[model samples]
Target: MEWTAAPARLATASADFEADFAACLHWSAETDAAIEQRVADILADVQARGDAAVLEYTERFDGLPADSVAALELSQAELKAAFDALPPAQRDALQAAAHRVRKYHEAQKKASGESWSYRDEDGTLLGQKVTPLDRVGIYVPGGKAAYPSSVLMNAIPAHVAGVQDIVMVVPTPRGEKNPLVLAAAYVAGVSRAFTLGGAQAVAALAYGTATVPKVDKITGPGNAYVASAKKRVFGTVGIDMIAGPSEILVLADGTTPPDWVAMDLFSQAEHDELAQSILLCPDAAYIDAVQREIDRLLPTMPRAEIIAKSLSGRGALILTRDMEEACAISNRIAPEHLEVSSRDPHRWEPLLRHAGAIFLGAYTSESLGDYCAGPNHVLPTSGTARFSSPLGVYDFQKRSSLIEVSEQGAQTLGAIASVLAHGEGLQAHARAAEMRLKG
Candidate 1:
């Protein structure tokens, strides 16, 4: 089974790589307005009718019986029981992953008391106070897939940021909770766990329900409907970001094993059909080998059809003349997961600027970052790494500026403020400051 390989050839380079890169934006805004409208109606109903509407919608959409919303709440004892039910190895793994995630997020926590004061000649002082949100809601996707990792990633950060209460919402398909998810919630120190999910869950978190209390901010990932609902409820309740389809871009040299790269590419593709998996290699032979390896491995994989469709439609084997070219292309894609399977990953790390989360070297697979590798897996997708960030403790906290001024300082500062206000045609503002200055 010899694979046909192509030799490296330098193609004509284009100056408008940015425009070429900009073309990818066309893939994102395919948001279904009709779906959004339906989700909006459901959210409105849940907000207005409270627990009854939530139960009705959960049943209608999730094909489950409408149980009491109170039943959604998992007790500490129940969580502990779930933990105890797990096999010894599975329990140990969860504990180890939780510890690693907690340590990483603990380091990311901001010092709340941090303050800087600058006094004017008149004894005016100005500073800022960092504070954590009073309460936060974390949405964990449930049903067929149990993401204990999502639980760890979202809750640990909020905990580290000193969020007083962390409420988690997970969809219980057919009105049943995944024991693993519940156990992980307990281990991650979540204050409460609810079996609600989807757009209604987001609404419940945004606008309080009779059973589920409203939170200051909501952080976690969900389906398209949930993402749209979050976008709609932004000001009403703070949200992390509107996540898009998952993506991964691998920059591999000829030195790396093609099978390893192929498996890594499939890792992201199996997430969904919309998920993008690409490979950028300088050596054309390596590119061809990886493509062949993908074909070889696809038939053996559990999600072969999904990966094949994803690879054929969204994935690519981009050929580059050198590692520098590969890096430049990667910066353009700004993939959610970027793997540098090159001989010298550190040497190229500085040159590689845009990626949601980077996996360096052949040994570090994207799966590590997804599961136990100490970084938040709930990262920005659909090239959002260009401007956004992966979920962290900072996302769950807020900062407020502090100012203290003496009478003399107010006189001095108010004069300047009054002038600026007057220039802006704000007479009332000017008069208010003028009165302070005159006093």
Candidate 2:
């Protein structure tokens, strides 16, 4: 309803651009202290009481009546039935999305998931052995909505990497289950699924229960409670990453249509209250045009209030000196989604350095990457893109260092190891190397 309801306008020429941008980018990833303590209590309860606690929490939170956690398990036949029952168009779309996701991860496996070794002149074998996780629990959020795409994104990579057991946990609040999610599980080759969620589900995956097996790692995003639970159970079981709010940064060159850029910003803004959306452009006239378009289109969106809140809370329309300056600012933010909405995206892409996933050109919408795009949609949020990465086959697969020293190779390595170990005051380590040396 309000034209200026989106974000405030800022220009690099102003003295406060740096300060204003910093304020926009600030997002504390810390969980609420109360949530942390509550999660701790739930994890302890689950670990100590096992299936009983799981069932209690399931009933309390999800309002699902179940005598036992075992009863909540969905069979392979049930999953397949859900898939088969879908309307032709929906089923076809799900399959198409899954197929693209699978194809991309399969290529990723070949590129970075294979094991390799090289023998040295002295016959020393040095390499890395790549192996998929034995079992992993994927927590799909159900309280708000079902994400069939999430099922494809998380499970397809693990399946492609040869993970034997892909256990999925989805909260069936009020005894309701989304058939699309189950169908995705079937198509993605999930080994087991449980109608359980929250701290109990994560604890079951981390510590194991009578009905639920402990997983090697846990992946997927959830609410505050789930994020807190994941953090607490980390060392006991591996976790993907503690992601922050969704974000999008657009570096526009004023060539793309203003409406296209406005909708691009809205794509992330609608995700949640904390989600951020920003646009940087050198053309002041075009920035104004995009702002007008955002106002004109805001009321039409189903999630208008949310978009308005997110845009007003964290979004920005910044006018930079040039595209290069915009790219530099983008690096500093390291957004989850970066769109190069220019006539020639490649020209500015090389200037950009840090982003979870980059959407090039005006036609390549960030929405495509979230759904049908071959790339994994699970990406580092907030500024984690500076050091972290998009969830890929690498996240589901781990590596072990391989070292096999030949008899002659041992002589060469042993001498070096002995001196280094002695210098470090580790006598046993020195002697162990000495023992391997030929007399």
Candidate 3:
């Protein structure tokens, strides 16, 4: 296939621009019937048979046999051994990334995770009490790829929030383990870990098996089956999100190098065939330059096939009337990662309000945010950025309202409650409040 072949082209000046843009943004997170049914059966089977079912699914799906699910669990000593055995360079990189992630989350905890209470004029104390979850499960995609970064992202935040038991789960297909993942677990302070994946792993986490203890919440991204499983087990246990495919949109003002922008698009495109990558610029000439750069540099990428399929399938090179129009369209798209590759990024940043993470200026690439940018890489994907936020310490904490009514205050509140309860014709409720009153 010719590398210079263009991606879908769109002009904001067109009469049917809205419809076209909507088409590009459309992606249904709903899993297909077969995957949903399979996930349902797996979740139910694991719930019923516990460790035996997990073992069965792990063997059948991952082609790994374990006498017991407990045998699949990696001990802390093994995790630390993996960390110790990594080459010096890899060890330093992992430690550096973890340190930065931990520092960022510690700051996040100070900003939003503290408990506070205040006494009112009536001498009644009221405020929110912040508490960390007892336990959490971090799912890292394993087998073909090892994302040590994901281990740091999910586990470190919960650790910062003071979660005592952080259980890590990864699919080690055919008993092939990634040392980096285990190393991350050791560094991030995971209390337990198991070699498991898919709906069965999620089910094991949601409903405690004999081997895997149930967690207060589950947080991480996964394949379609994992996504479906997360959604199914939501009410039974809290979940982070049913995340859609990855996406990135760049708003260029013809200042940054076309090669840089082209590579940025390739970054998200290489994630999967359905991942979306688009560039919106007023300069048609610059857009053409980026297209050429895409053609030239794409052949060099190891995942060229995935990048090509992603670009041709869902990517676009859009022309807008001006930067203002570009920002307007970007808000509508509410992309996962929005890069303002311009001279004065801040000037456009105020106008660009909706994105999971904004990469500013000519130098900032979305890849930095994914690794060690001090901010969370676990962002809201698809248009969920319009309403949601990046995963943080807050996601691992819960709040409770504290109320200590003084004697005088109770008298005042009791009369109000009695009146309302009597008005609602609930005599028992009125009497209960009246009992608190003296004389």
Candidate 4:
């Protein structure tokens, strides 16, 4: 079947540009009410019945009937075997990606993930103690496609952060396992893995089954059920973020080839129908050329239908006043992935402040960042990038403030504490502080 791609075209100077832009950018992140309720029930059932519930759900959903959750577990030897069995190219790629991801995360840890202390003149020591999570569960999607990269991106950072146990859960529908995924688990240093998935898998991770150990946090993306389960389990355990549909926004200066920009847009549109890919450029002729390239190149894609639907529904080709205006608009959108496809990408990059990851210059494709560019691929979506960040070593570690007071410090601190405690009408707190004050 022939596929067509026609993204909405808008000029910033047009009076209706605001309305057109809003319509193109709109995507509701609200989970379906039915899915939410179903997820709640699944979480409750798993919390109550533990392994039995997990086994039943795995059979019903994944078509893999396990006698127990233990039956679903993937052993270290199996992971190693998967790695050893891979073709040399696959093995080399996996190891190389893991190495770069590990290196980047190690650098990230050294910069921020550490314990520090400082002493004041009064001999009061104050600082922070940084520590890694004891255990974390990373969910890898194994439904439509297998992502070995997800395994590396999620687990490597945790490993670098010193997480002792990285429990991996990948839903293998019909008991079919992806060797690449298993190989990635081995390469990324996953401590434990299970051929399980869906909200049931999430429930097992969030609330410990008899066999599945409860994790301190859960990271990685999944389908609706997995997302809903994560939302329900947030208080019980930490979650990376509630991700939305993938997005890529290109701020073009018309210097890059139209075909390059068109393919860059296609890179994200193929993710799903809801995924968005937009181009903001000042040159109307370049925008026209890009649209022509999109039309010419889209039909050649294997996922051409999906790209067509995504571009027709949510994508845009906005003609901005200039690069400055394009940068401002990109910040307003705060897209998941932003590409400055321009001659002087660095000049515009500083002006852009709110994307999950910025790919500077035409050559830096978003796909590179998604796979092996070192920085994490799991990023905040749906304008969440405005405040949050990409998944990194920090996500797998926590910090605690350290304080130690000497006699001299307490003497001064106690008097101040006594006044504040009394002001709040807490006599016990006031007396406690007053008791420590020098007479």
TM-score of each: 0.91, 0.98, 0.97, 0.99
- Tens digits of lDDT, candidate 2, 46-88: 9999999999999988999898899999999999999999999
Best by TM-score: 4
269-364: candidate 3 lDDT, tens digit per residue: 989889999999999999999998998998888888889988888999999999999999999889999999999999999998899999999899
Stretches of candidate 2 off by over 4 Å are 1-4
Better of 1 and 2 by TM-score: 2
Clashing residue pairs in candidate 2 (N, C-alpha, C atoms within 3 angstroms): none
lDDT of each: 0.83, 0.92, 0.93, 0.94
**lDDT digits (tens) for residues 1-439 of candidate 4:** 8989888989999999999888888888889999999899998999999999888899999899878788899999999999999999999988998999999999999999999999989999999999999999999999799999999999999999999999999999999999999999999999999988999899999889889999999999998899999988999999999999999999999999999999999999999999999999999999999999999999899999999999999999999998899999999999999999999898988899999999999899999999999999999999999999999999999999999998899999999998999999999999988887787
Better of 1 and 3 by TM-score: 3
Better of 1 and 2 by lDDT: 2
Clashing residue pairs found in predicted model 1:
none
All candidates in order of lDDT, best leading? 4, 3, 2, 1
* lDDT (C-alpha) at residue 190 in model 1: 91
